[model samples]
Target chain A: MLDQLIYLFRRVFRNIRQSPVLCSAAVGTVAVALTILAFFSLIVINIQSLAAHWSEEIQIVAYLEREPSPARLKQWRDGIEAMPEVAAVRYVNQQEALRRFKSRLGSDSDLLEGFGAEILPASLEISLREQYRNRESAETVVGRLRQNPELAEFNYGQDWLERFEAFLELLRFGAVVLGFFLLFAALFIVANTIKLTLYARRDELEIMALVGATPWFIKVPFLLEGALQGALGAFLALGGSLALFQFFLRQGLVALLSVTGGDQIVFLDWQQQLLLIGTGILLGLVGSVLSLRKFVRI
Target chain B: MIHLYNVCKNYQKDAASALHNLNFKIAKGDFVYITGPSGAGKSTLLKLLYCAEKPSRGQILVNGKNITRMGSSHIPQLRRHTGIVFQDFKLLDNRTLFENVAFPLEVQGKKRFEISNKVYQALKHVGLHGKLQKYPLQLSGGEQQRVAIARALVVDPLILLADEPTGNLDLEVTLEIIELFKKANARGTTVLLATHDQEMIRRFPRRVIALENGQLVNDSAP
Candidate 1:
C-alpha cells in the first residue's frame, strides 16, 4: 500500500510538471473565484455583526402624560419588567431626562439654555432581552405596551429599525444567490480547464490503459492533481483576501465604521476559513470527476 | 490456453462485421502469427482476446475464463494477465526507459524493491538495461519498440499479443524485435503476433493463421 501511494504521488507530481502552464491556469481560476467569494463573505459577515450590535442597543421609551406618584412609578416598572421579553425597565424623571439631553450635547449644551426640566416629559425605558432584540419581537413588546393608558407616546426608532431589518434581509438573500452563482461558475471553469489538461495527456492515459493499469489507477492521479490545485488556489485566495483586508484597514475604513457605532471589522473566523478551503478542494474534485466521466474510459 | 467459439464483432450497427464466426484454439506455449491483408480483422481479433472490445456475438475464453461478456471493471484484470504491444510503440515520450518498463509493475501495485528488480530484469531481457534513463524520443524506432515490449513482458503475462510491432523498422531491426518475441515465447509465454510481413514469416516460420475478409481462410496446423 505504501509503495502504491509513493508511485501515485510520483505520477501526480510528474503530470503537474509536464503541464505546468495548464495546471497554473487552473489554480489561478480557482483562486480568482474563491477570492471573490471571500470578499462578498467579508461584507456580509461584517454587516451582520454591525446589525447585531445595533439591535442590542435598541430600547423602547414611553413618555408619560404627567408626573406620576412614586407608587405608580413602581407599579409601572414592576409590570414592564415582568414581561417575558423585557430585560429591564427604568423610570427617568423630567429632571433626569433633561440632564441626559444636556450630556448628549457635549460642548454644545448652550443650545438648550432656554429650556427647562418642566418642558421635558418623564419616560419609562424598556430594554428587551438579547433574544427578543429583533424587529418582530420588539414590535410585539411595543404592541403589548400600547395598552397602558398613562403612556402618551412611544419612540423606539421604529422606522429606522424596520428599514435596517429589511435591508439586512435583502443583503442575506443576495449573499446566498450570489454565492451559488459564483460556486457554479467556478466549477464550470475548473472542469473545462481540467478537461483541457486531460486532453493534453490523453496519449499517456491510453498508454497507461494499454499497460493494464486499472481505471482507478488512471483516474487517481488526475483526481489528486485537481485536489492539489484546489488546495493551492484556496491558499492563494485566502492570502489575497488577507492582503485586501489589510489594505482596507490601512485606509481607515474600519476606523470610520467604528466611529459610526459599528464593531471592529473582522476577517473570516477559523471555521469559515476552513469552509472556504474545503469548498475549494470540493470544487477541484468535482471538476475532475466531471471531465473524467466523459473523457476517460476503462 | 486460449479459445474462440463462433465469435463475431461489428463496430457499428448495420455495418460489416470485423470478425465473423471465428473458431480457433491454441494450447499453452504456442507461438502463432495472425497474417492477413490490412482490413482482415487481425487487430480486432487481438483486441477481443485482450478484452479491448466486446464481441457482438459468440464467446472467448482465455485461460479457461470466459471474457466475452466481461464487465468494464474486470477488463483491467484480464488485461493485466495479457500483455499487448501496438504498432505505434505506445511509449510515453516524456518518460525514460526505466519508467516505461516500470509502468506495468507499478499498475500491479508491486513493492518498490520488487518493482525496481523486475523493471531492471525486463529491461535487461531486451538488452537495454544500460539505457534505462534514455527517453523514448531519443531512441531509434526499434529501441522504442523494445522498451514497449519490455513494459509488456515486465508483468510476466501469460499471453503476449503483438500487433504489427515491427512494421516501422528496417529488416535488421525487424529481425531483432522478432528475436525478442521468440525469446519471450521460449520462456513459456503464449505469443500471438499479428502481421502481414511475408518475408519475416517465411524466414522465422511458426503456426500461421491466415484470415481473409474477417473469416479464417487457413490454419497451418494439420
Candidate 2:
C-alpha cells in the first residue's frame, strides 16, 4: 500500500512539474473561486456582528404622566427592573429629558425651550436581556410595559429597527445567493482548466487503459494535481482578498461606517482566512474529480 | 490456456454480432494471429480477451476461470495477466518514453528500483533504451509503437493481444515489431495479434485465424 502511494505521488509531482502553464492555469482558477467565497464570508461576518451589537444597545423608553409623585416613579422603576426580561432600568426626570431633547433640536431649540423644561415627561429607559432582542421578542416586551398606570406615552423605534433588520436579512440572503453562484463559477473554471490538461494527455490515457492500468492509477495523479492547484489558488486568493480589503479600507469605507457605531466594519480575521482557503481546496478537489470521472475507467 | 465456448459478442440492438459462435482453444505458449479486414471482429475479439466487454452469449475461460461471468473488479486482475497494444500507439504524450513503459510495473505496486530496472530492460528489448527521456510526439511512428510494446511487455504478462499492431508501420519497422512479438512468444507468452497486413503474416507462417462479418471463416496451421 505504501509502495502504491509512493508511485502515485511521484508521477503526480512529475506531471505537475512538466506542464507549468497548465498547472498555473488550474491554480489561478481555484484562487479566483476562493476569492469569491472570502468576499461573501467577509460581508456575512460584518453584517452579523453589526446586527448583534445594535440588538444589545436598543432600549424601549416609557414616558411618565405629568405631576407623577416621586414614590410612584420609584415604584415604576423597581417594577421594570424586577422583570426577568429587563436587564437594567434608568429613570430620566422630566427636566433632564427636556434638556437632552433641546440639545438634539440643535438651533431650533428655542421654540421647545419656551414651553419650559417640564414639557417633556420623565421616561423609564428600559434595557431588555440579550435573548429578547429580536423584532418579535422586543415587541412582546413593549406590550408588557404599556400596561402601567404611571406611563403616559412610550417611544421605541420598533418599526424602524424592524425595517433595518429586514434590510440586513435581505443583504445576508443576497450574499448567500451570490456565494453559490461564485462557487459554481469557480468549480467550472477549475474543471475546464483540468480538462485542458487531460485533453493534452488523451493519448496516454488510452495507452494506460489498453495496458490494463487500474482506474485509480490514472486518476490519482490528476486528483493530486487538482488538490495542489486548489491549495495554490487558495494562497493567491488570500493575497487578492488582502489587497482588495486594504484598498477599500484605505478609501475610508471602514471609518465612514462608524456612524453605525459598534458595527466595526473590517476584513476577515485569521480564522476566517483559514476557512476561505479550506473552501477553495474543497472546490478544486470536487471540480477536478468530477471533470476526470468520464475520461478514466477502472 | 484459453477456451471460447460458442461465444457471441454484439455491440448494439441493430448491429450484427462482432463474434459469432467462436469456438476455439489456445493452449499456453501459442503464438497466433487474428487476421481480418476492418469491422470484421478482430478488435472485438481482443477486447473480450482483456475483459473489456462480456460476451452477449456463451462463455470463455482463461486458465479455467470463467471470464464472461467474472465481476468488473476482476477485470483488472485478468488484465494483469494480459498485455495489449493498439495501432495508433496509445502512448501518453505527456509521459516520457521511460514513464510510459514504467506505468505497468507501477500499477503492480512494484518498488521504484524494481520498476526502473524492469522498464530499462523492456526499453532495451524494444531498442529504445537511448530515447527514454523523449516524449511520444518527439519519436517517429515506429518508435512510439516500440514504446507501447515495451509498456505492454513490461509486466511479463502471460497473454499479449495486439489490435492492428502493425497497421500504421512501414515495411522495415513492421518486420522489427513482428520479431519482438515472436521473441516474446518464444519466452512462453501466448501472443495473439490482429492485423490486416497479409504480406507480413504470410512471411511468418504460423497459426492463422480468419474472421469475416463476425463469423470465424477459417482456423488452420499455416
lDDT tens digits by residue: candidate 2, B1-222: 989999999888678888899999998999898988888999999888888788899989998899998986677788887888899987777778998898877777778889889999999999999998999999999989998899889999899999998889899999999999999999999999998888987899989899999899989896
Model 1, span A1-298: residue lDDT tens: 7767887899899999999999999999999999999988988888788789888999999999988999988888888899999999988999999999999999999999988998899998999999988778878888888898889998888999989989999999999999999999999999999999999989888877777788888999999999999989999999998898777742455664554533467789999999999998999999999999976687
Residue A101 lDDT in candidate 1: 91
| Model 2: DockQ vs. true structure | 0.59
Q: How close is candidate 2 to the true structure, as a TM-score?
A: 0.92
Per-prediction TM-score to the true structure, in the order listed: 0.93, 0.92
lDDT of 2: 0.83
Q: How many residue pairs clash in all the candidates, one count each?
A: 0, 1
Q: DockQ of all candidates, in order?
A: 0.70, 0.59
